[model samples]
Target: MKNVIVRGYDIPAKTMVIANIWAIMRDPGFWKDPEVFWPERFEDSDLQYKGHDFHYIPFLSGRRICPGMNLALPDGMKPEDVASSEAIGLLFHLKTPLQLKATPVF
Candidate 1:
């Protein structure tokens, strides 16, 4: 890593650059009605969570991404079925506890 200029700003080497994912995801410039939970906005767009598109990075991007980044929904549940509630805290999280019932399959 070496010192480089980014967006006209000189960033020194080893300078930690933390991406404000929350703010970025909710930025009105990139998203319409960002504060509203509208999953359909991505239904027709080319946005991806693979970090290719900086606008949407749920599991993060690049080599440091989560191994289990590939995930699926439960058999009978739909995307809209999941309730979205933000808990009041420093970090982002759902206010309601997630309850899942697992059925063993042979």
Candidate 2:
């Protein structure tokens, strides 16, 4: 059901087409006044990123869909908020060395 033949040509199976998601979502052929930002576009509509609906595929669809996508997406908490639990594991490893001068109190 994935492959489709058109004009004696095959689109192939499991092909990675470099499609422009921005343009596709704004195309007038499929949507009316598509350039507008309408969150209600999918209101009561079957169009979804659950795989079959090719129009919108955010985390993708089918078995390859992102498993942790339903985390609800947050803006992230400050380091001070979770100081005990949070840890920096980045790759770039950019930091400035600090110098300290301390005196012991009696």
Question: What C-alpha lDDT do the candidate models reach, one value each?
Answer: 0.70, 0.57
Question: In TM-score terms, which candidate is top?
Answer: 1
Per-residue lDDT of candidate 2, residues 1-106 (tens digit): 3797868878887876686866776778887777676645665767555547675544456676767444332245443443233335764332432223344556
Off by over 4 Å in 2: 1-16, 57-106
lDDT of 1 by residue, 1-106 (tens): 8999989999999999987788887778877887886655655767666646765554456886766435555678776878788888899899765556555656
Candidate 2: residue 60 Cα off by (Å): 6.9
Residue 14's lDDT within candidate 2 is 83
- Work out the TM-score per prediction: 0.51, 0.38
Query: Candidate 2: deviation at residue 72, Å?
Result: 7.9
**Model 1 lDDT, full chain set:** 0.70
- How much RMSD separates candidate 1 from the native structure? 8.0
